[model samples]
Target: MNKKTIAAAFVAVVAAAGIAYWSLGSANAPLRGSSVAAASGNKVITIWRDPGCGCCDAYADYLEGNGYVVTRVDDPNFDKRSIEAGVPQQGIGCHLAEIDGYVVSGLVPAEIIERLVSERPDITGITLPGMPANAPGMAPTKTGTLKTYAFGKDGVTVYSEE
Candidate 1:
């Protein structure tokens, strides 16, 4: 088979597997609403993203669904804002959020976001790097674990896994 055919087949297989997993009806399903409890239902998140990015909309929806008050703005200087917010150059993602004085870079899970709020980490914020397949906004394939990194004066470090 050609390369395109093989890649298409692989995607089809993964999609089938994801469907089967979802059929199990587990509340802890990957990429669904995060299981972590909210630190405060009144918390607000302001997301700066490109208006053309559909995944950003999905990410905003995920945050709102988890009790966060989401305000999405299509900022022309999103990259500049992220850099100014202390997001490391390597940790930059498609979108950025300002939450309770922390800069969240990327489609970070609500669980981790809540943990950051509850624990009050000293870091500037957390990032998920490039968008992962099963991340909150991305297409779900039930892939391997997603790594989140914390960035600040101490530099980038593993924050959590989901």
Candidate 2:
């Protein structure tokens, strides 16, 4: 190939690599809401969710509306991270959150989260399990009840019901 063609090819490759790097790097970056939380002196909660999960975004909004500073991180492997953080495989939620050294999984209500933070339970974390129809991020229809479980070295146990 001519010098100009080779140069153009190299430039294209470099541009593609840069774009890829940026996209991948941003997956772990904190969402824009984090800065607002910091400025308002609210408690910061870092949540890891799968990319393009609208429910997770709604949950974050709920948390923010409830006066918590939410810093969201898009992680495709959020379930794995939740399990690694002491959540059982069966207890994996739509998202994983870290607040006040506690692991909160799924679409737990803000009230329950506040209680968890207030009571300072001895468990490693809490989980709401799978997506429920009437959960905070789900549709606004009341289901029978929602159960939040606490899991640690001992095992999973009923934490609360809402």
User: In model 2, what are the clashing residue pairs, if there are any?
Assistant: none
For candidate 1, the 10 contiguous residues with the lowest summed lDDT are: 27-36
For residue 35, model 2's alpha carbon misses the true position, in angstroms, by 17
Q: Residue 70 deviation, candidate 1, in Å?
A: 0.2
lDDT against the true structure, per candidate, is 0.76, 0.80
Runs of candidate 2 exceeding 4 Å displacement: 1-41, 141-144
In candidate 1, list every pair of residues with a backbone clash. none
Across 1-162, the per-residue lDDT of candidate 2 in tens digits comes to 999999999999999996665434344442222323343555678889998899999888877878876767889988877777888999999999877668899998888887877787898889999999889888653366899999988889999987
Q: How far is candidate 2 from the true structure (C-alpha RMSD, Å)?
A: 10.0
**Tens-place lDDT digits, model 1, residues 20-113:** 6643323122122111212345667777888799999988887888888776777767777778778988899889886766788998888888
TM-score of each: 0.72, 0.73
